[model samples]
Target: MTTALIRPTADLYDSWAAAVNEFDGVHIDGSGLQAPVVPGRVTLDALIRDAAVLADTTVAPPEDRVHNDLYWIVDDREVVGFLSFRHTLNDWLREAGGHIGYAVRPSRRRQGYASAALALALDRAREIGLERVFITCDDDNVASARTIERAGGVLQDISDQTERGHSLLRRYWIAL
Candidate 1:
């Protein structure tokens, strides 16, 4: 399957919603969608609007957030995952969030979509003139750690304390 990252669009609402609903209350890390997704609560128009706002650097972000580029991971015409590339790191990001975040739909996990998407994100990061990027995953998420390592990420350190939804974060840096 041909995997690519595309900006979220209204035309793919049905496909995106289907994949998102499968999360069953789990957080979709990179999706701009609100956490613990309430089925039927997120409208397509709202999602499209939110995505536009997130991608618009001119628009000031909320106090605790940074401007980010959000993309939907598509395999051909289906939305299988989401990714967020922060333009700059905020305090929280420096501690845990990192420069890039991503999540594959439950059904799409272990299929290499995350790897392909991360590779694509890295290319975009380079094109935007980033010298390197920081990334983190839960220490227990062996698959994600492997994905980052495969992308040339070197381990920095693991956070000593739990932050947010993650128990312990494995931080890595990929030099571009």
Candidate 2:
């Protein structure tokens, strides 16, 4: 029941509101949207706005770019588990955000959703002509590291991402 990234329909927004209200770990999938966002009905418009930067010549070219949202149909409802991306991991991106991000609802974790979602996202990344992509996880996030490993992610470096007082960042790379 996966659908291409599109404007948030009324039904989709309503479902997203309900799911995220009760599920803190479940992030709204916005990679599929026209821009980068937290993936929620509340931020849809803003996300679209950020994505508009792509139209500027100052930004990188738009080829081989695809954003994706990971939605899980639970009890006949669409519960967004996480969002990932298939895009260019520029120098800045390599240092911080990497190429993907994901989260699973606390109540729905340990059920393999993140693993499945990431695997799917990586497949899409390969389809977009990425020979390899960088993905970062918190050093303490064993679950996330395992998910990356399952997707064939190889450890690259562990750097302190505390410039703004954040935690350690572990970088990995996966070959398509």
Candidate 3:
């Protein structure tokens, strides 16, 4: 089952917390979750408050970072992945990060979750009236490049990236 972002309900909060440890040091695209997943540092209230601050235009919009989170349910009740859909892009995003980003839990990866999640996020991008959106992946992230392609993304160009592990960025554009 797949679900879009919503205010975390009690059950949803519990679901998110259960997997928090699995993603302690990992960053999932579009989830908007902060890292470290410390033992006593996370609470349902805190998550809700943080998300509210992010969604509140007066609080978060000034930085050109307004985004919505989409959750992926893997079973009757657990979130397997998430995507962050930015309503608008800043300079860096416009050139690299693109309009959407996402990730699946390490435990849930290799099960085709990211691909499905990307497709779903595109639907979301469409819902918001986007005509086309950019999605970029590291040059070495073959899976992500494929996922973007599978979602109808066309190659845009290669960005000049020099990350520790890669020297290029594969950029794509998907027409909604």
Candidate 4:
């Protein structure tokens, strides 16, 4: 199946909601969705609005945040995952978050969605004139590490100190 990244929209709410439900209490990285996302508590309209705001580079991000673009990873007509591309790294991002973040829906794992999305994101980074992008994954997340490596990500080092709620993080840099 061909995978593509698109901005979040109201039209894909049903599929997006279903994917969100599949997350349960786990964090859906790259998805700008707020935590403890109860089904009825979050509306498609509100999410769409928030996504728009996050993607608006004209608007200044908060002191600790950087301007970012959020994209839903779609395969066919299904919302299979999400990706976030930060235009610049903040101090916290420099340590852990990196230039991009993404997550494949739990049900869609191991189907090449993430790898495809990462490849596409690298293209986007190049388009934006970035020479390279920094990425990080949990030290225990072997699958993600492999995904990064497959994308030509060179391992920098693993940090054991806590940063942005992650204790052990493996950092990499992917040259565009």
Per-candidate TM-scores read: 0.92, 0.70, 0.79, 0.93
Error of 1 at 49 (Å): 1.5
lDDT of 1 by residue, 69-99 (tens): 8899999889999999988899889988899
Off by over 4 Å in 1: 39-42
| Cα distance off (Å), candidate 3, residue 28 | 2.9
**Clash pairs, model 2 backbone:** 31-67, 31-68, 32-67, 32-68
What ordering of candidates by TM-score runs from best to worst? Answer: 4, 1, 3, 2
Candidate 4 regions exceeding 4 Å error are 40-43, 161-163
What is the per-residue lDDT of model 2 for residues 97-153, given as tens digits with 9 covering 90 to 100? Answer: 777776665667787777766776777677778888888888898998899898899
**Model 4 worst lDDT window (10 residues):** 36-45
Error of 2 at 5 (Å): 8.5
TM-score between model 2 and native: 0.70
Residues 96-155, candidate 3: write the lDDT tens digits: 778888776778877887777677777877887899999998888888888889889999
Model 3 residue 141 lDDT score: 84
lDDT of 4: 0.87
Query: What does the lDDT read for residue 20 in candidate 1?
Result: 86
